[model samples]
Target: MRLVVCLKAVPASTEVAMDPVTHTIVRDGGDAVWNPYDTAALEVALRLKDEARAAGQEGWVGVVSMGIPATASLLEDALSRGADEALLLSDRAFAGSDTIATCYALTLGIGRLCAEPDLILCGKMAVDGDTAQIGPMLAAALRLPVVTGATTVERHGAAVDVEQVFDGARRRLCMHGPGVVTVDKDAATLRMPSIEGVLAARRTSVPVATAADLGADLDRCGLAGSPTQVVSCFVPERASDAVAIEGTPAEQAATLAYLMGEVLA
Candidate 1:
């Protein structure tokens, strides 16, 4: 069985600045890390792979990412965790991709990985955009069943059982293999890489594929394919005088209750 995990590299800092003209986060010259949600997805994928191995089955885990060539380092982290191989989709033509365009590029890359994949895992959302649209969009483009916001997953034969969280409620879902899953942060904690894992990752080669390599249609691969355009960006006006209410314990409790009621109401 082959499992593919899609990951995105996002800005590491919480205080991200927006481009005045583009209405998008200014990403250039910033520290980057794997999206936190994607880390959970990776952990789940690794656990699944380990289970398969322990059961005497041959399982392969692949880390697949779409970004600039420099972002290939992001795959190294996944490799150090447990993935068998890494595929990087990078090209100048893939620049300025919106969610739709991203899904298109990702579909093309995934197509090149293998004819069929037993499972595909992705983060519930990418921190840079926070739209949480690419995973479902990719599933739509590929015409595959998708389970989003999955917090837990288990495989039984060729089928998968997933526990999905939605609006504070958990729903159990069952689907056959060759499906897509977008995992939430509550799914699992990420595993730290051991020294041996790090050295192994450093020695492993990451194959890079471009638009030409993927044979992607030029009219539907990047900025040219994006239908949405940003108009402008500006910082929101901040409150001039932020007030703090402090008093005796009783007074503080009363104030907190009043605020909560007002907010809820």
Candidate 2:
């Protein structure tokens, strides 16, 4: 079985800068970190790979991401965590992609994998975008069934059982293979890389594919392909409500005690 996980490299800092004209977050030349939710998805993939191997089946785990050249580093990190191969989709033509366009480019990249993936995994949502649309959209593009917000997934015969919290209840679902699962952050814990794994990952070269290599139409990628545009991007001003007790430590403590007593009374 071939399992593929879609990874994302998000800004490491909370204070992200956006392009005023494009209204897209600046991703180049910044320190990037793995999306925590995607990390959990990768963990789930790795566990499934282990199970497949133990059952004497062919198991391969690969990771794919779309970003600038710098994003290759995150793919290498996935290799360190036991992914067999990594592919990076990076091209200037892919800049300023909305959810639909992003999914379109990703669909092409996944097609370039050595073999058709039996299962595709992704985070329920990316922290940066928080749109939570990629998994379902990618599944649609691939003509596959998708289950989102999955907190647990396990192989069951020819199908997989997915469990998730829905409508304030835990629901389990069985879906056949050649499907997609959008994992919640609580699905699994990412394991630490071993020393040998780290060394090997450092030596592995991640392949980069561009729009041309994927035979992607210029009209179906990047801002051109994106139908939705961000009208505005800005941090909302926060209003604070609080009272400050100004005095030395003892005075402040007494004032706090009196307030508590009053409240209690």
Using TM-score as the measure, the top candidate is: 2
- Give TM-scores for every candidate, taking all chains together and pairing residue i with residue i: 0.87, 0.90
lDDT of each residue in 176-260, candidate 1, tens digit only: 8589999998889999998888999999878999999988898887778888866665558987965477999999899989987
> Which prediction has the highest lDDT against the true structure?
2
lDDT of 2 by residue, 46-68 (tens): 99999999999988999999999
lDDT values, one for every candidate: 0.85, 0.92
List the RMSD of every prediction in angstroms.
3.5, 5.3
Question: Candidate 1, 188: how far from true, in Å?
Answer: 0.9
